[model samples]
Target: MSSSLAPGHPQVVVCKWSAELVRSMLDITPHVFVVLDEFDTAYMNPDWELLSRAERVYRISDFDSNEEISAVAADLILRRASIDHIVSFTEFSQFGAGYLEVLLGLTKDPMRHVAFRDKRLMKDRVRLAGVPTANWITLADPSREDDVAAVRETLSFPIVVKPVAGSGAIGTVKVETPDDLLPTLRGIEPDPHLKSDQLTAEEFIPGREYHVDALWSGDTPLYLIVSAYYRPRMSVLDTEPGADADATPPDGSYVVNAEDAPALYSRVTDLHRKVNRALGITGGATHLEVFERPDGELVFSEIATRMAGAWIGAVISECLGYEIHEAIARGVVTGKIPEVRPSRPYLGGLHLRPKGPGRITAIPDEEEMLAVDGVLRAQRLRSAGDSVDHAHPSEWCAFVVLGADTREEYEALARRVCDELRIEVEPAG
Candidate 1:
């Protein structure tokens, strides 16, 4: 960690939706440059007034290649406003930012960024490093019939399929049988953010799933929290036939005590360290998901080189008594990791989705939701006229935050909140 080129401010290049996050970083040091996406201009342009408060803004579309991005970054460096760090807390911006970082001499290796972006490459590296992961094969052209045949011939039933480069569980699916395989494969629409046309067909590991969120200083994990989802993320996509994607499915997640499940904790943390090392991730926040088989074997799910989305950062802050974003900002800017750890015993967060697709007619009152015992925060992400897409968890309409002294207490509070909360929607016509 070197000091910022400027007297006190470190110039950082951030990508996509991370502009808002830079506000907290400004408190630690000034000079945040955001790279925007052109497609987002239609909705984000109006918000630019507030975002422009940063030192500078660049658009990804403006640069045709990584070389161009590096060229512009080099010009900035020559002007004595050298970028101290190039970072993106979102999957969309990681690869490009990493390339720019290497070009600007910010990162020691470039493959670290590549591993973060390409799932197939990542799995290869993890396997080579001797970390346990599901058996997987890549589909270069998913639309091709032969590729679908390859998946059927090789992988077992209930195989997990997802884009080689995707986030937020957007195009992920579980093929339970041969009949469901081709349709599920064909139904995966292209994502603009995913640069690769390849798809992954991996053996589905059945077991309890958990995610570990941690901030690292090189190979050392400075802080860690393990969370278990009430239901696996992919299950949210398994809706009833004719159901709308916006319809909310049943889902909840809560932080778990490491002491209560020491064996599980040890296995997860050990793998987390291995994955970080395999990917060459030396710093920044990481979000990794793993599975615990019924037989008690641990298997890797996936890893991201960014903070967990779905408001997990907020939940972590609420439980730990520190803002993860602030710690990450300070770490990247000054190369100093915080000493803070989780202060609370147990905390949980739940999302309530519309029962079916339609216009949202009504929602539970905020005051009523907050009144629930152990409920810390209640927010309605959708309004009366807003349409709900039930296909994915990302379309869920409302969320509740909860805290309790014990896991039993947290589960009780979450169940009560779900049972009491009401969200009415008219079936889509």
Candidate 2:
């Protein structure tokens, strides 16, 4: 590996690894240093060619921590003459990359990144900007009765409890009442991804949920995609009393066409613009989740400064004739998101989970899924012999991206696929 970069190749430090993302970054510059966590490196098993192409690759035990990121930056500063950009393609490493951006004097004002990472700070900034958010109270000490009482006074039953800086729905609990508050909060098992014991309990807003993914050029918007969920994401946390776990309905989202949903597109994009301006979002990508009340008021759920996960990018690429990561890479290099539009009327990814806890006797193969009507792409992450764990609904076994010429056809196709597909599981292996 070389310690110095060739002229005209900017020195870029990538906080994580993605074959396509790294490849795109390297296309513009040979001086790319990739920082990856050991677990991701092992699970992804990136190709040797991509790893070899990067100027340097650092595999540390932890990539999300400030200490680890700072240490790596210090080492890079000592080795290289100058660092141009520190970027993160995933949610977990966004803070680390942004933190380093400021520490290296690449940007000013740490709050810009800190506000995005810390739920409390994020809410504070968003609310101060007059964007409606769930009324929340932070627990300095979840074990302390005083903190719990504060939540009871400020919020109602069925509030949500979550880590101050956590992503996804992991480590989140919905507390129904005062009695259940302490027990639920205490029952949250610790995970390595959880950065702090501090939790925030906020009022739960019930409504249809949707996420907006956008690419921005500084303060201006480049492109935005709005997708509505088939069901509340929090529903994945619990299995219905008698529902079959292995036969659980496909839980996923679909892209909303701007013309098909002109009003929805306007509302979400307008809301996103407000939040983006408030958060100081600039030349990059973001995924914002929001809820629409029954009467049509949009409430803020939370926003992340990274790409949407769960094969969203792939589905978007399949429908839009381009990749979101490609747009992001281009934005990083040229401060612009290339113009791209949806080619299909309806597009979405349907995710399937094991209905019941058991041994998997069978699962549809990729070829079988592709044969289904309107199915454009299919990916099977599990095998016939793999054990089925319904407890974690997020761990989907397979998914298919569906494309259609009309919304009616899209709905029919989704139902047909769900009813036809089967995940045969036995009580024991």
On lDDT, the leading prediction is 2
Model 1 regions lying over 4 Å from their true place = 1-10, 17-20, 38-55, 59-68, 192-195, 237-249, 335-343, 365-368
- lDDT (Cα, tens digit) per residue for candidate 2, span 1-429: 346656776777877778888888888788888988887778988777878988888877775667887887787777753787666768778777887887787877877887887888888888888889999988878888888889989898889888888777767778888889878877887546666778888998899889888777766667788888877788754653112444434487888888888988887877888888788877577888899999899999899988777767777676557776677777777776556766567898888665677787888999999998788888898888788766444666888888889888887777777777767778864
Q: Count the backbone clashes (under 3 Å) in each candidate.
A: 8, 8
Q: TM-score, each model?
A: 0.87, 0.91
Q: What is the lDDT of residue 318 in candidate 1?
A: 81
Model 2, residue 183: C-alpha shift (Å): 2.7
Candidate 1 Cα lDDT to native: 0.75
Clashing pairs in 2: 218-283, 245-354, 245-355, 245-356, 246-354, 246-355, 246-356, 247-355
What does candidate 1's lDDT look like per residue over 1-429, in tens digits?
343356756677766654446776766666877777675564554356656677766665632367658766766666667776766787666777778777778778777778887788899999899999999899888878898888899988879888888887777778899889887776877776566668888999998888899878777776778988767888754543221343222676788887787887787888888888888888888899889899988888888988887757778878567777777787767667556565557887777776677888988766877888777777877778888867665776777778888777766666667667868889876
Q: lDDT for every model? A: 0.75, 0.78
Where is model 1 poorest over a 10-residue stretch in terms of lDDT? Answer: 240-249
